[model samples]
Target: MPDNQNPNYEIKTIVEIFKQENLTIPEYQRPYKWTVKNTNQLIDDILLHQEKSKYRLGTMVVHNNNGELEIVDGQQRFITILLIAKVLSDSNFLDKDISYFLTHLKFSNTISHKNIARNYQAVISRASDIVNEKFAKFFSERCEMVQIILKSESEAFQFFDSQNARGKDLEPHDLLKAFHLREMNDSDSSEKIAVVSQWENIKSEDLAELFALYLYPIRQWSKRQSARYFSKSDIDIFKGINLKKSPAYPYAQILRMLESFTQHYKNSPDRLFDNQEVNFPFQLSQTMIDGRHFFDMVSYYQNSKNKLFNRLKENEQTNRIISTLDNQEYKYRTGDKYVRRLFDSAVFCYWDKFGLIEIEKAVKVIFLWAYQIRLTQQSVFIESIDNHARKDLMLFNKIYEATHPKEITQLLVNFKIESKAKNSESVINLAKEFQGIKNEK
Candidate 1:
């Protein structure tokens, strides 16, 4: 273990790595989640790389816990590699080291155990003709990686922090999911499954945009800050108290008490007659509930944001003024798109804090505030929209500060048409609509 004897890292073939002492999947590691399709993709990637002299699979971070090497990242691919080895070793197509790896390696999360079996079958089904002795040898030797051996577990996360900064493939949601999973050290398998299943069902890209477009901006603007981007550094705003592990501070205690009450209400037989549901009180800027509740909150907001915005055409459920805003007369203006998002975000902030009470009025107020910029400016930019949302209208702040919906709905928005603006006739008609809104009680 002396510095003079070993380099900080090493580049090795998958075959060579198998010959070394096995890497440990610490008990804290989350379940193996790579799907059968993912396993098939790995097989295809290996076959594609067979023609090359060597292909770098990617970097892996391993903590040197005294002498034991524990996997810190890349566990998805790590487990996939083991499943591949198990397949190759089964047919006697691979060498002794791979066979030894199969016999010696063990990781026992229940979800992982189930996935390992499913993916093992998937590898055989996908690779039967493709993974012959030549492909197996190529995968073992020509596929390569660099294993980073840091002295402590925190170093592993630090390494990922730097990697994300450099814009590597480490996804922010994935990193946060794994971090919160580690916090759920005492969670039973079913509880973990309940949380993981919902998350795995949503596409990662959708998750990213949900945070960026809706969740992240609302939190920052509610606090009266500019939130143009939601990067890895900004994720602490989303990560919240772990009830069991976080200190019993007053805020944590309130969240925990609410968590307990909500669970009890949902499970109680008295609530069954109405077939009703209870939603956790979610505010745009409240402290998150950490593990299971964190996952549930994300799922809730993700669904809520999609309600009227994602459709190509309107329905009864769709907010009609949204359709009005999109009417062809003025929708083609390039800046109108930014105005639409600004309007929706403000309304969503109010709706989150105060519910659908006078939401129709709230929408119109937000709409008049939003599109007023479009009517006056020859061209609108995102910075201008950011200004309007954060400070110009103080729209988000009003909602953030209000204890009741009346404070927002009862406000008057006054505006005038700029006749010189492009699309004068459409702008005049749109300006006229604000008159009716002002006349409403």
Candidate 2:
């Protein structure tokens, strides 16, 4: 390959550069990701420049030796800049200092900074056969291909990375979003609308964070099971799918799922402060599991004439128990069969039979007790999840004892809190009382 040091390089305008063909990203490269906030910030930066006496022109480095011009860096800024240029395309601003500032800037990077730059320089130097002919049209006036004579592809890449590091960072989600958007560009407007719908209003940065957290599992699963790594591209696609599917959340098995969601929302309060975003404060309630009373309740519900407990137990077993790791644990758990049967025996009395939502809450309550039993084996006060689980356990037994005539009335002979039907309400019900929504509007 010829050396890339002696090619014509200059700065150009948004109208002068064309995206011609997209440079391929390597397997090791991170994804293109940006949140709404980041996108907004870029726009704001351009607007800020326009407000000043002179417009700020960002550097767009291009290697034009090949049939197709490759963009080694500045993809996000380039796009954002394009958006600004488009907005101001016909305005007087186009010929003003702002436009002049944007159009006449040159960007240069040498391979000395990094090995990749050397490779990039080489590719540019021998672009005649290095790049595909089909994408050559993209290097036209639209992108203002300010051809930079670099030594090699490595040189170009190092410049790209360094230049980008000095400005805004590219994220996996932004790239994914860009890819999807570009892929959909050729489709009908209606179809394109659907694609855009998938690109929610999350800031590009927040989107990246969310993608990192959620895609971790899928990434691991893919790598471990397939013995192949997943690209940010793969993760980006999977994230769209996950957003669509609304994957079931088993709070007990993976509290991280719940916690991650909360953490992101908390971190970006600007986005989440509104009632629509996160109205309900997430709480993990803890309840006490009176071993004897619980076992007895299980037995009574299993054999009760009313058959309330059996139905609840059955629901719990089929819905919750089998879904847990312990159920599959080779160490302790036996068969889910007996558990399901026993759970079935409790269904009639369990709150779930009354309503699905209520049942979900009830499962949490029961799980709190089970979690306590697990923790009791380890230590008191289950420190991992705050005191939520412990509190739930205490409340469950409290409510159970209060509701059960003989149990609470007799047990309370020596206890402090009185157990009575009126007093044995679920915490949720008590919360309603506290909210004072007694008489609905």
Candidate 3:
């Protein structure tokens, strides 16, 4: 084996890469899942940039295993280019010998090959005039790619993963994965492989959506603010685990907290464990740099019954109330936006305290406060509900430090009482009625 510590790299045209080495897709690689839309866009990009002195496609990561170059990344683009060459050859656009040699290039026997072939035909049919000798020459000779030849397959994959995360095309969570993976350089190879495998098991689109819809909102709400879209910078909050300079290391702190909880419960007669409620959420903590905890929390909320109202397992009444609110029939008439906002706020508050014990009362009071705001406010847009939820969340955070559920209820009650005094007669009446139900209970 050569000294792969400093691998060779070069800028090569499509024709040069093809002529200089034999390229093959490794079996572990994902099948060419690029759609017709993707191929069409690539074609359009190439055509638009064809007039430039040199059009750079992108970087390709490859490993030389006994002189055979295995493509570790950029297979999709490479295969697409090959299909273009084949299309031109079939059209008799290239010199006979050049066309014949192009035909000999092999592709992996995957479903993607068939799909790519279909897409090629569709592309050629749509833009037959573009698939000429001149365009073929431009694609082969003028278009350039950065060919990165790594020392080993692992290095090639590491390069591919790191570059993909930093690249413009990645989702925010993908960037997080890349950042954490970079930090784990000192970890054993098996540990790193396990992390990557587990991370990949959850699809990128699903992970991104999880952050956007739930985790981001909950984190913001915990600070008593309206939720915004998750961006690149916010990834730092989930980071800092491996950094030594940080005063509060999340990984160590979380492990200590779990240890304390276990010790506290060991002597208790009332102790019981529920997989859905507790065990599953803690399972992710077993791993270092566990972003899995955040994901697990989101999953718990998504799967729980009466998610908004029922925080504690014993709170049947709160569960019933939330179930009623979540009913499609009720939501259809009342609009889901108000209910969703209230649910999110309640969840955030519960999560901040790190347990559902005595959470039902807090959630009940918070829900009523949110309901009153919706009923009293004019022109109740989604934004208005979100603002109210954020305000409530802020108040919750302030009193959360006091370590008592009554403080939360009292704060919400005080806010409601103040708002009720300044509002219209109808609003006052509604508040009185809601109070009557609470008092009676």
Candidate 4:
């Protein structure tokens, strides 16, 4: 591509190319990193100049290179204009007089005015593929794309990359984006995390917003920059706590934070800083955890559970199931196979970790097995079993896994129950007996 020292170009609205292929941001060219603040400023500039130029001058700086005007520094601004135009179009704000002026406002309109005007519709037709809808319609009624000459696509791409990277100070998420895009080929498991993968699918602007909401809290928590960096280990610790137990669901944490932020600035939508927006109420101090840490904790918990469930499901290794007793908590009823596996695992964890006395463990196990089988089997004779045995069994089952039948024999041997066959029946048979008991009572 020929590099023009002072590339002469004409301004075109982005809406003019609405149907054009999104120029695959060349691998060398970084993704769009402009902040909302920067975009808002560009809008200010465009509005100020457009008002001064009577919307006829169309104060856009387009460089002439090859097929289209290569918008090096103004792509985001052009995009914003298109968005504004869309809003205006949806509102039916554009008049016929304004449209007519936009149709003939291109460089070709002044160059090969007559010949270009003849094929103006065709050129605008192609140009509309890349142009924004609002600006394209605005220009179509006035000047046409046939009025503009060809420009080099490569030169435009190069200019856009060089100028944009130099102008903006990228945020943490921006750097993370660049890192991910550059090292997407990495083999690290952390890199393969679902949270990171999901981040890759969204726009850089959205990613930055998420990062800011979460990272800003870390900044507050730390005395050093290194401490401000949120890591997988920190998130892992938070997730462990979450799995242990909580009054609220994991998602509630982030939603709670957003609600807090929104409430803090409800009166002043324009303010960026919380202090500038309003006096932040210090109520419910417990809810004031850092947004990033809280979100990461929840994300890690959800992602880990997802990973474990998927892994187990794929391997058909769901040996220990602890299904919900009711539908309210998104629980499913437990099947017999699931119950047995879960009981075995719970005994393992409790016996190995908590070191319950052997006699106590046996007493607990037998009682639990009897009660569970009765509950599931609907046994009628459960009332005939000693009340103490029933109570101990229920308590033990709650504290550990009640699914494993092996625990029953272990309990019988430890308690040294002389009459093993006295109360002994298959859980299914006991269930039948329990049902009869229920009818009798």
Candidate 5:
């Protein structure tokens, strides 16, 4: 294995990569995962950029094992290009490395074989027009990729991890994990491994929901910003001050202060016999602390959000309020669902702030605030729900600034319940139960 300090990597046409050596698929590589949609996307991308002198397709990493270039990444794109060459037919003129790929390529996974066959048909239908030599040569000679050739498979994998982590297919949470992990450079290696392993053990969809449904909206709403969309661009919200590189700003100092106290409390000698473990008090709406705290905060809040429902269930009044909203006729409408999300988000942050203190009233206040938008508007949209989130008193803003439960739970917004709105008159009358306000109609 050569020193990975400087791996051999450079720009190469698809032809150069293929012709260099026998492109072998490593055992670790997942079966070719490209689908018809992915293939069509590649074709459209190729067509869109064919006129350029050189279009950098993307990156590929290969482990050069005894001259056999084992593909550590870009297997999907590599195979798709070969399939394109095969469709353009008599393409021996363009490059023969891809021919070796087509003739010898085998997949043990049935899904791979199925998708390969499906994408083959797609290419035939899409690439038949490129039967002429010009387009074929352009694909073979003009399109380039950054081909990273590492000496060992481990080096190849390391290179692949560094490059492919930011790929288009990743969700925002995945990006956040990568970022925070990088920030944990000074942390204990074992703790870093444990956090990442624990994170990966979770279902991907749940992590996505944690960020998009709860964390993102709550963060934005607390700042009095619209959060209808949570995308890669908004990940900076979770990435707070990197303490290693941070100045002594009071906000950053507060997180540092809490970190010191929590660590001392947990590591204090009394913990062993008493089992009085103290976790860093993580407020969902608080300014984020960087690195391990970010990961710990994520794991904590995820479990906290799940446990909150059970906590709510423990209280009869909160249960009754929840039951009331759940039984509403408009419960399943898109607007109604958004309204419920609004309620749940507020409940999540409220409980985070006050530990279910007067949670029944807290939930009722949130319910009235959220569901009122649904009852008052004939058609509630993402915008309406988001706007209503910060409308007037701004419920999240109230929760953020308040030191007491009543500051949020007791706060009320006055808007006439529109009886003409789509929600059954029954949902409108729930205000009477929730807040003692009757529909003006």
Candidate 6:
């Protein structure tokens, strides 16, 4: 248990937080990513517990960076409650004092700004009739948060991780946001805000889905390994470059060089206002930071021209292969549930590196290899086949980087499985089809 004597925290009610204290969302914090569903659920929860004398919302870990209280955890909940307050104030449901306090509340410009506004309005519209002065009074007075204020930034994050592990875990992306944001602590406010906006603009669900379905799998495949479930630790894979720790920390060396040059150039500098060292405040480009770079990569993957389905719409050969796979008559089930994830990984890798130039050949080879494995190996459990296919595809991808389809086909054929003869036959047919495509090209 943390030391109680010097916890440096106090329990604050909604009214107290708004009336007495000034709160700021740290630049490291992700923008408001809560959806309307989350907003409605919170409202419902508050309403459900309104009968009680006091309701505890939960814990919020904050850091007292000098005098400014930077929220480290419970950002989602904090923003949601602020939205509730906004609704109450707008509807004239809150007391004059509380409403005035809410009026002074400020929010940083985050990517989820529009969504937050939309959801706030929705809450107001939904509770227009039900929320009155009495309801607002109860909320401000009764709803409480155990605000734990820590002295150091590291302590705040440790507290956050410990609490999240015990309680309802935040999504992996949320953790990544926090981690990356911490790295940007010294960055200019505008840089932090811009990165937060880009990070939040990508829907939370889409970010999670992309990592789980495509990015994670492709990464694993490149290493000649089967993709496993994504976890918080996997966030490191997406973190492309660590700006702070890198030797080429773009500005630090240059700043030092500039300072030295300036000192040498001036023998006796004019005694200007209060001999304070001149500080250079500059924002690094997004590409310099890991968090921003990761988001940029995700954006690229999502909108890249060489994307499989996007290419399918324009390329007849690509469409034909996909069509054949989708056709029910061929027993090539492309149903949502039955879609081979391995093929998705393959397409992502091929497109990410090579683009549309050789996309047809790549897609056709991947689909046929995947299709044949799916067709012939029935007796073996589906899970085991999936595991094997991932490994085979992983190996094929690595070898394919240096060689062509023939070598990739040979690598795929090497995987030992049930019904070897049938698998071999399928591979032969695929090779023939692949050769015909190459011949035509």
TM-score: the better of candidates 1 and 4? 1
Q: After superposition, how far is residue 170 of candidate 6 from its true place, in Å?
A: 3.3
Off by over 4 Å in 1: 1-13, 16-57, 62-71, 79-91, 97-144, 148-158, 267-276, 308-318, 328-333, 419-428, 436-441
Superposed on all Cα atoms, model 6 deviates from the true structure by an RMSD in Å of 9.2
Among all windows of 10 consecutive residues in model 1, the one with the lowest summed lDDT is: 310-319
**Candidate 4 residue lDDT tens string, 1-441:** 355543455443343443333221122222234444544454444435432322442333343533434333433334444444444443454332234223322331122233334333333333333245444343434332211222444344344434435545544444333333223223343433443434434555554433332223222222112222333223221221121134567655664565567566765655645546432322111232332233333343233333543443343212112222112321232333333333333333233223333423332443345335434342323122223222434333333343443444354312222222223234324233323333233
Q: Give per-residue CA lDDT, model 6, range 1-441, as digits (tens).
A: 456635576888887777645566765466666788888888888888878999888777788888877788887888788778777776777653554434544456545567778787778776854478767988888889988888877677766765665555577777667666666667787887777777666777788887777776666656555556677766666554564456866555664464455555443465364464532221111122364445555566555523557657667877766655444443433322233566666666655554455667667667765555554455434455356555545443463364444444343332233333332333344545664533233
Write model 1 residue lDDT over 63-140, tens digit each, in one string: 887787878777789789878877787778778455555656565556778898999888888666556888887878
lDDT for each candidate structure: 0.75, 0.35, 0.60, 0.35, 0.76, 0.62
Please give the lDDT score for candidate 1: 0.75
- Estimated TM-score per prediction? 0.75, 0.28, 0.59, 0.24, 0.66, 0.70
Q: How far out, in Å, is residue 178 in model 2?
A: 12
Worst 10 residues of 4 by lDDT: 317-326
RMSD list, candidates in order: 5.6, 21.4, 8.4, 22.1, 8.5, 9.2
User: Predictions ranked by TM-score, top down?
Assistant: 1, 6, 5, 3, 2, 4
Single out the weakest 10-residue window by summed lDDT for candidate 3. Answer: 276-285
Worst 10 residues of 2 by lDDT: 282-291
lDDT of 5 by residue, 44-145 (tens): 888888878998888778778788887767888988887887876554456454556666666655557788899988887875566667778888788889
**Candidate 2 has what TM-score?**
0.28
Task: Give the best candidate by lDDT.
Answer: 5
Tell me the spans in candidate 4 whose CA falls farther than 4 Å from its real position.
Answer: 1-8, 13-51, 54-75, 95-158, 171-441
Backbone clash count, each prediction separately: 0, 78, 1, 53, 0, 0
Q: Which portions of model 5 miss their true places by more than 4 Å?
A: 1-8, 11-58, 61-146, 149-168, 423-426, 437-441
Residue 103 accuracy (lDDT) in model 1: 59
Error of 3 at 407 (Å): 6.1
Q: Which stretches of candidate 6 lie over 4 Å from their true place?
A: 1-7, 33-51, 83-137, 165-169, 239-241, 247-289, 305-308, 328-339, 379-382, 389-441
